[model samples]
Target: MTHNPCLSDMSKRVHRFPLFSITALLHINSTSALMLGRGLTQVTHIKLLLFFQTRHTG
Candidate 1:
């Protein structure tokens, strides 16, 4: 199967600039983060969700 370059690029970008990803997550509201997380990889989605949850609870 052909890999999607856009997804690959995004994965790379996420890895390369993790702080930026965190910052973006912080700026976005929970609903928007949930929607955005749906498109991420399973592990990444979970990680972001946990991070978002912790930010709110802690």
Candidate 2:
């Protein structure tokens, strides 16, 4: 049986949408994770500095 030409193009476009959205989501998640990692590192650095300063003063 011959298929309709209109649905073929439309179906391809529909399939592409999910792939674009998934990659966009990946970019957002990676950026968020990087920011979180940076924040955690800064907090750890501050804690270490404070601990050492207190030890030296005492």
Candidate 3:
């Protein structure tokens, strides 16, 4: 996956920087993070739904 500038910089500074800076960086890149989070949530929900449906029907 490709990262935006804020994410790249956050990765570089993650260990060196304080929590405040990290939070600020996260906010700067919140759009990407939010999208990724929603995508993951949807995938997980779909997988669980499929698993349950198969187990119940089969």
Who wins the lDDT comparison?
2
Off by over 4 Å in 2: 1-17
Q: Taking the tens digit of each residue's C-alpha lDDT, what string does model 2 give over 1-58?
A: 8999998999998887888788899999999999999999999999999999999998
TM-score of each: 0.32, 0.68, 0.52
lDDT: the better of candidates 1 and 2: 2
Better of 1 and 3 by TM-score: 3
Write candidate 1's Cα lDDT for 1-28 as tens digits.
Answer: 9989999999998788879778777878
Candidate 2, residue 39: how far the Cα is off, in Å: 0.4
Off by over 4 Å in 3: 1-28
- Candidate 3 lDDT, tens digit per residue, 31-54? 788999999999999999999999
**What's the candidate order when arranged by decreasing TM-score?**
2, 3, 1
lDDT of each: 0.85, 0.95, 0.89
- TM-score attained by model 2: 0.68
